[model samples]
Every structure is written in structure tokens, then in C-alpha cells.
Target: MEIFRNKKTFTDYIERQKEMGKRIGFAPTMGALHQGHLSLYEAAQKENDLVISSIFVNPTQFNNPDDLEKYPHDTNRDLKLLENTGIVNAVYLPEVADLYPAGLKSKAYNFDGLENEMEGKSRPGHFDGVGTVVEELLRQVKPDNAYFGEKDFQQLAIIEKLVQQLKLPVKIHGVEIYREDNGLAMSSRNERLNAVQRDAGKVIHETLVKVNDWFRIITIAEINKRVKDIFDDQRGMTLEYFEIADEQTLKQTDFFYKDKNYRAFIVVNVGEVRLIDNMHLD
Candidate 1:
């Protein structure tokens, strides 16, 4: 696959491909390629004539400087994984300056209160950073369709809103959450966990499974308390937040509406490694 480091070169190439009438698919990510990320590529490839992706551990999206510093990066392995995909037509590796240019600053956005719940409430300015870098990537790539993982359900919702608010002409597709044998969601950050922590990580998904099972018979308030109680007793982990929210607005709700779509969102801090996952609660 062709690799373009220069922003204009990649943009020009995409433009040329568009002129040739090839439908473009994009999967933008930080450079820690895994099966979960590749799943997005597979999803894009099935629908588009060409598939492209970018590797930029966006500094803007990181609220904690330590997190910005600690976020994983293995360009060689990442590229090799992309190469192995065989379906990836091209790769874009943009420098911080290429995307940011001015400095490591994030542009502010109003996600219409969508940014004020769950992950947004925990990480200040996180969605703004997400909005800034994603807007830049979407504009530069300008693909007919962009793919995201449902693991980051909140982020996906915010990005869909971003596309609408910015009036970007691209469809957003959300792939299902990919997990490990232990049922822990696959993530680059998982590399940070040791064996025991990895075992402990299973609890996050385990709890979600219970949440899904209990949604039909239990009260939302009771489920919320039960989730909290599980993590409260879980060893070597902290439950950052477990929210049963409306699938669309993402607002945490104690009352489940009969006709509304609902999803369970969760975040857990395993030692220093933070992990997140979500499930469709029917």
C-alpha cells in the first residue's frame, strides 16, 4: 500500500481517486493497530472501492498530559498489521504539525450536550479535542464513508453529531465491539496490563453481560447500584462510571422507556490502564 506522510499529497491522492469514481472508505485511528481496528478496515472494505486509514496518536484528544505521553505507539508493527490486511489501499501518517499546524491546541465545539455525559463528564475538553482532530481528518480524507468501533459508543455518537453539525458529506458506520478470549475489550492500552490485571480486566465485560441480562427484569436504579457494588468489591480496579443511557442522546436515565433504544456504557481503571466498553441493553 502507498504511504503518504504529507497531508496535501494524501488529500490530492484521495481527490484523484474520487475523480476516477472510486468510492473511498476511511478508518482513522491512533497507531496501535489490533484486530479490533482491523475489523473497521474490513467493514470499510466491504462497502467501498478503496480503503485508507491514518496513524496519528492525536495529542489534542488527550486531556491528561501523562496519557498523551503514555498512549501506545508502534509505527512499524502498526504498518505491518495494515500491510497484512491486504485490503488497505493506502495509509496516511501525519505529523502532529501536519494535523495541528499551529500548536497542540483543540478547537472548541458544542456537541449539543451530547459531550456533557459519561466519558465527556470524566475527561474535561476530551470531546473538544476529539471534535478538532476528527473534523480535520474527515475533511482531509473526505471519504464517502468513515468507520468507528461501537466500543466507543459515546465517541461515535459525538462524531455523528460532528458530521451533522459541520455538514460533512460522509456516512459514519459503527462496527461491533471486538473482545479477547477473556471477554475484555481489545485495546492498545491492554498492552499496559500484566497477566493478573488482564484477568481482572474481564470483570468489566462480565459486569456488562450481567447488566444486559438484568435489564429485562431489574430496575435501572437497582442495576446501577449492582454495577457499582461489583466494582466496589473488585480487586485492583476502579469503576470510573457505569451508566445505563439512552442510545441516541446518551443521557443517563434511571427509567427505561418501552420504545426507546438503550445501551450500557462503562469505564474501568485497572491500575493505571483505563479501559472502556459498552453493550446494547436491548
Candidate 2:
């Protein structure tokens, strides 16, 4: 697959593809590719004539500098994987200056009420960085469709809001969250976990599964307590937040209504890496 590091070159190529009447699909990612990322690429390939994937470790999105520093990267391996997929037309690997030549003067984004809970509350200014980088990428690529994983469910909601607010032409698609056989949600951050911590991380998903089962008969408060109790009992796992909320608005609700869709979202620190996962309750 062709790799373009220059923004102008990539956009110019996209323009040429436009002239050929080819529909484009885009998937933006930080390196460290995995099966979850490839699933997005595969989904894009099924619907679009051309598919483009980007790998830039966006500094603007990290609230903690150390987390940014600890984030994984391996360009050679990533490129090889993309090539193996044989569906990716090109990969955009832009330098920091390429995307933000004037430095990060982030614009404020109003995601309605979606940005004020869970991830928003824990990591201040995190979504702003997400909004800024994602906005810039979408502006640069301007693809007909973009793919994002449901693993970062709130971030996906915010991006959808951003597209609506900006009225961008691109269709934002949320692919289902990919997981390991044991149910640990796949993430680039998973690389940091030691063997023991990797096994312990399974508890995060296990708790979500248990919570989904209890939703039919239990009160919301009881559900919350049960989730907490599971993490409390597990060593090396710290529950950040767990809530059952409307799948669309992501606003935590007191009780699950029979007709509305609901999902359970959870975040935990296994070792020093933070992992987030969500499960839909029909």
C-alpha cells in the first residue's frame, strides 16, 4: 500500500480519486495496529471504492503527558499489517507539524450534554483535544465515509455531534467493539499491560457482562453496587465509573426503561493503563 506523510500530497491524491468518481472511506488511528483496527478497514473496503487509514499519535488529545509518552508505536509493523489486509489503498502517517503547523489552537466544541459525563468528567479537556484532532483530520481528508470503533463510545458520539455541528459531508460509521477470546476489549494501550495485568483486565468486561444480566430484575443503584463490588473484590483493578445509560444520549439514567435502548459503560485502571468498554442491553 502507498504511504503518504505529506498532507498536501495525500489531499491531492484524494482529489485525483474524486475526479475518478471513486467513493472514499477513511479510518483515523494512532499506530500500534490490531485486529480491532483492521475490522474497521475491512468494513470500509466493503462499502467504498477507496479506503484510507491514518496513524498519528495526536498530542493534543492526551490530558496526561506521561500517558502520551507511554503510548505505543511501531511504524514498520503497522505498515506491514495494513499491506497484508490488501484492502487499504493508502495510509496517511502525518507528522505533528503537518496537521498543526500553527501549533494547537484548539477550537471549543459543544457536544450538547454528551461531553460532560464519564470520560469527560475524568479527563478534563480530553474531548476538546479529540474534537480538535478529529475535526482537522476530517477537514483534511474529507472522505465520503469515516469509520470509528464503538470501543470509545462517547468519543464516537462526540464525533457524530461534531459532524452535525459542522455539517461535514462525511458519514461517520461506528463499528462494533472488537475483543479477545476472554472478552478484554482490544486497545493499543493493551500493549502496556504485563501478563498478570492482562489477565486481570478481563474482570472489566466480566463485570459488564454480569451487569447486563442483572439489569432485568435489579434497581440501577443495586446494579451500580454490584459492579463496584466485583472490581472491589478483584486485585489491581480500580473502577473509574460504571453506568447504564441511553445508548444515544449517553446520559446516565436512574432506571432502565423497557422501550429505550440502554448500555453499560465502564473504565478501569489495570496497572497504569486505563481501559474502557461498553455493552449494549438491547
**What is the RMSD, in Å, between candidate 1 and the native fold over all Cα?**
1.1
TM-score on alpha carbons, each prediction: 0.97, 0.97
- Give the Cα lDDT of each candidate: 0.91, 0.89
The deviation in Å at residue 50 for candidate 1 is 0.5
- lDDT digits (tens) for residues 126-232 of candidate 1: 99988888999998998999999999989999999999998999999999999999999999999999999998899899999999999969898899889999999
**Cα distance off (Å), candidate 2, residue 41:** 0.3
Tens digits of per-residue lDDT for model 2, 1-282: 889999899889988999999999999998899999999999999999999999998887788899888888799999999999899999999887777778865667789979888888867778888888888899888899999999999999999999999999999999999998789999998988899898878888888888878887889999998888888998887888888889888899997777889999998988778889999985
Candidate 2, which segments miss by more than 4 Å at Cα? Answer: none
Report the Cα lDDT for residue 122, model 2. Answer: 68
